[model samples]
Target: MALFNKMLASIGIGTAKVDTRLDSDRYLPGQTVQGKVEIRGGSVEQKIEEIYLTLHTTYIKEQDDKKYTQTAALEKLRLNDPFTIAPGELRTMPFSLVLPNDTPLTYGRTKVWISTGLEIKNAVDPSDEDFIQILPGPIVHAALLALTDLGFKLRQAECEAVSYKLNHHRPFIQEFEFIPVTGPYHGKLDELEISFLSVSEERAEILLEVDRKAKGLAGLFAEAMEMDETMVRAFITKQDIPQMREKLNQIISRYI
Candidate 1:
């Protein structure tokens, strides 16, 4: 009993407590995430200036060929404004958050953390970080599998901050690079870069950049192209490995 009391004190439960639970452990892009944030009062009453939930993801920023870790806030929600919790009281607040469609799904299981916090002026700040697993959707997985089946190997993956100068919402672009399979075109293509934009259940924009190796007569050049929703859907779902390889080869041949 004495040890239990000491453990509770270490957590500042005598002040305030917070717990956030998600409705579902696994979620898809463009889906609403439902959760409950429960706050339990401690030995004494406390005044909370505000109660809010924040969603964050980690990325790497590259500058001058150097990389640095960066944490970005994706979304935020406010539950209450200046609320008072009396001693021996327990309160639970429900929250429904719609995750961004373009959120990157980790290769396998990515850990995404959400924080529920109560802001207090004098007392220790009480907060909870919940780790959620992010799984890749069928469309995304299919595309990658097709590329792999075609003999293209994954080279690198990274998230880049991109500005179109015409879009309203700031977009973070995740780029996947692959090495070409076999053929004269295999060595001819330095790498295949793919990007997903405006990603959602209904539609997604696909962007491709092909870096071509320079021939004796041809100079090194890169071609960039954007595919519409209909084309993207067709390419991901309908095309097979051979067809995908041909489609990519055709695109590369035109430039060379």
Candidate 2:
């Protein structure tokens, strides 16, 4: 019986399993997530090399005109040194992870999760995955509200590939698409897309891509020449929210 039990444990049939339990399901950027990882031993004694946590999220990637969802690790944490878990033993390790300021929120099909794993020699590793919701920081919320106040209705929002110049850890960004159906530029513009290039407590860089509607012969000629789309960069601060509408309107006026 002893020989059979050791054999089973070696193959992970009776090894330790890891599970992380978070206090909450929703977290804001720059906030701390408190949790505990519970390690439960199976039918026999097993040696756990270490315990680690990884923050992962899914984003869209394009290859050969085909879009695919890919998982990326945003952060990693190793909790402890090697330890032995006796048969049917239960152990708990408490932990906390600091959410990054640039972390993208959970919106428009985006998913964020944490994976906890047990590292054991000569055995199949055991892991647990739990999804969490990310909330937008102050700057992003303010910008969205300002656009709504400007008569722009959100049409679509998605996470898509972005440029390296944006200084982002992820290869993609969350783009908010809007259209002015009743605003000052209703008939003049087709749509507007906004992306947060970089954001901080004191400053943020936003990208605005505007598509204009073609009207008469002159407008059609400009459209045919591929001049109906314009991209503008805006450097703004929280204090600028009161005037952000006017600032964006001025930029649209030039294209309209």
Candidate 3:
């Protein structure tokens, strides 16, 4: 009976299971995420080599005219060391993960989650996934609010794959898409896309892609040729929040 139990455990029939519970389901970028991992032993005893938590999100990638959603790991945390668990044992370990300052906000199709797993040799690893909401930091939040106040409405937000030359740490960047529905540039521009190049407590570096509205035959031709769009970079600081509207207006007016 003991040999049979060991065989079952080897095939994961009596392996350990992992579950993670977060203190909160929502967080801001750069915030410290606190949580605890729960481990429940299965029908038999098992050895856990390590416990790891990985932060993951999905991005859209285009290959040969086909679009694919790929999962990317932004960060990984290795928890407890090797330990042994007897039959039907229960263990809880507390952990904390500091979210990256550039973590994308949970908007539109963008989603973030934490995956907890146990490393067991010669056995199926038990894992769990928990979704979480990532809110924009203060600087990014101010920028979005400023755009809204300027009469722009958010249309969509997504993460798209980029060249390694552009971003080395991650293969994709999150973009916030907005349309000038009733603003001063309503008739002059079709849409505006914003991407955070980097952000910090004091300032945020952003990339703006402004798509000009096509006008007559010439405009239509230019649009078809993909020449109606212009990309510009801007830096916004906490001090600029009060004047963000005017500042953005000035920058966009030049292109329009």
Candidate 4:
């Protein structure tokens, strides 16, 4: 017996059945995810008006200085224009969906949920929700590793809305903060902020901001620095612990 049969048996629905199959268990951003939806008529003939799939994501939003949990439809697809299923008949439909390049990377594993359903008139709805684990790409991993190698320890991470007019592009931005491991720079630098703008599998833009401590003397203020993608990648590939310390010293020396 098929898995759909087991599901239908549990639901006690003798009129309809639904099943979904994903092409792969893992995917990167900007990649195509393909899948198929299979529907089988139960013990009796059924009118399958339409089938649809919805991609859903759970995120947090802020309003009135308060945060709220919410879910949004990332993508949607209509599979059929209205069809009928005879008794014991099987029907299948294929679908292809593209994931956004700027999708936030989850810590361990996050679920990409796809809901498949059939809309029928004057009857209970039949649907299935499948979860797929999303993995981080190479660029993301490399950038994080570089930060750790620079004697920075992870503090906290959050996602905030950014404007495209500002050239941020994506609807959200992931912010990570790190503190200097140990050195005279510990008290001199408040923290380092990093954000990743992944454009593709191999290309990612990193934004770095340094929060410098203010001096007590006159004409002293905090300074900020920003590095582009090339500089960041080069730093990742070329710098060791001593070299990174020297680079930081150079940056601080310029301000003094």
Candidate 5:
């Protein structure tokens, strides 16, 4: 029976299992996430080659008319060296992984998670996935709040393909689309889209697309022809905001 159990475990019948427990439900970019992976042995002893943890998120890549959802690996961490697990034994390993400064925020349909994998010799590897929410970092949070203060109403946001000029690791980026209901930009603009290509504690790089409100007969023709939008790119340090809010008023004036 013992021999049968070992063979069965090797074939993934009753193998060791992994469970990851995070210290918190929410994490921020550039923050070190502390978690523990608990491995519980199954019916028999097994030799685990190594343990790995990875951060994963989905991206959409379109080819022709079909779209494919591809998983992007933000980071990987090797948990430990090879070890043996006796039947019914439980081992807990603690880990601290620093999130990427540009980790995509969990907004709308976007999802982010950490996966734990146990590599074993000649056996179907066991794995576990734990989903978590990613909140904007300090600089990003402040910028979003400032936009709210400026009367820009944030609407839908999504992760999509970004141009190379944005300068990002992954092939896509998250854009927050806004429309001014009040404040300085109210009537002059039709839409505004902001993409945070690079975000850190000190500074953040932004890509802004401004759509001008059409007017007059020529403007009406331009609107009909879809020629009313302009794109702007800029970067701001943490020290720039609030005052930058006032400066933003001036900068947007030029865009209009």
Candidate 6:
């Protein structure tokens, strides 16, 4: 029976299993995530080579005129050194990691999760996945509120693949689309797209693409040539939150 059990464990029939439990499922960018990795042993003794946690999300990528969803690792954390587990044993290890500042918010079709994995030789490694919700940080949240106060309503949000030159930190970026519904820009602009290129406690670097409403011959011609759209970068700090409405108005008006 011992030999049979060993054989079964080797083939993952009774191999060790892993599960990760987070202190909370909701978090903000740049916050610390605390969790525990639980291991349940199988019918026989097995050696675990390593345990690791990876933060992952999906982004849309275009290839050959077709779009595909791709999984990406935003960050990784390795825990507990190699150890041995006896039959029917249980072990729990605590861990902590700083979430990446560029982690995308849980919006639209974008989903974020933490994957826990175990490395074992000659066996199918056991793994676990825990989905998590990422909320906008203080600075980013303030900007969003400011935009709403200025009469722009959020239309959509999504993550899309980006070039290395655009963002050296990550392979994708999250974009938020807004349209004027009631305020000063109601009749002047077509739409607005915003991307938080980089964000932190101190400041947030934003990229704004302003689309102007086409008018007569000159405006129609500019639209056809793609000149009706303008792209610009802006930096907002904690102090700027109070005046974000005015500041955004000035910046966007220059383009319109």
| Clash number by candidate, in order | 0, 0, 0, 0, 0, 0
TM-score head-to-head 3 vs 4, winner: 3
- Prediction RMSDs, each to the true structure: 6.3, 2.2, 1.2, 7.2, 2.0, 1.4
Model 1's number of clashes is: 0
In Å, residue 234's CA in model 6 sits off its true spot by 1.2
Residue 98 in candidate 2, Cα distance off native in Å: 0.7
Question: Which 10-residue window of candidate 2 scores lowest in summed lDDT?
Answer: 247-256
- Taking the tens digit of each residue's C-alpha lDDT, what string does model 2 give over 168-189? 7678887889998786878878
TM-score of each: 0.73, 0.89, 0.96, 0.65, 0.91, 0.95
Model 5 TM-score, 2 decimals: 0.91
Q: All candidates' lDDT scores?
A: 0.66, 0.84, 0.90, 0.64, 0.85, 0.91
CA displacement after TM-score superposition, residue 244 of candidate 5 (Å):
3.7
- Comparing 4 with 5 on lDDT, the higher-scoring candidate is 5
Worst 10 residues of 6 by lDDT: 162-171
Q: Choose 1 or 5, whichever is better by lDDT.
A: 5
The sequence of per-residue lDDT tens digits that candidate 5 reaches over residues 75-138 is 9999898999998999999999999988888987789999999998867899999988999877
Return whichever of 3 and 4 wins on lDDT.
3
Off by over 4 Å in 1: 1-13, 108-111, 163-168, 181-185, 214-256
- Against the true structure, candidate 3 has what lDDT? 0.90
Candidate 1 is scored at a TM of 0.73
Better of 2 and 3 by lDDT: 3
Query: Candidate 1 residues 34-152, lDDT tens each?
Result: 98998888766678888888877766667799977677777888888788888679888898987777776654223466788889766677999886666656566666665675567
The list of candidate 6 runs beyond 4 A from truth reads: none
Clashing pairs in 5: none
**Which residue pairs come into collision in candidate 6?**
none
- Name model 4 segments beyond 4 Å from true: 1-15, 42-44, 108-111, 155-158, 161-171, 177-179, 182-191, 206-256
Residue range 120-210, candidate 4, lDDT tens digits: 6655668999876556566566556656765678887666555455476545566777787875447656677666755565456566666
Best model per lDDT:
6
Of candidates 4 and 1, the better by TM-score: 1
- Error (Å) of candidate 4 at residue 96 is 2.7
Ranked by lDDT, top first:
6, 3, 5, 2, 1, 4
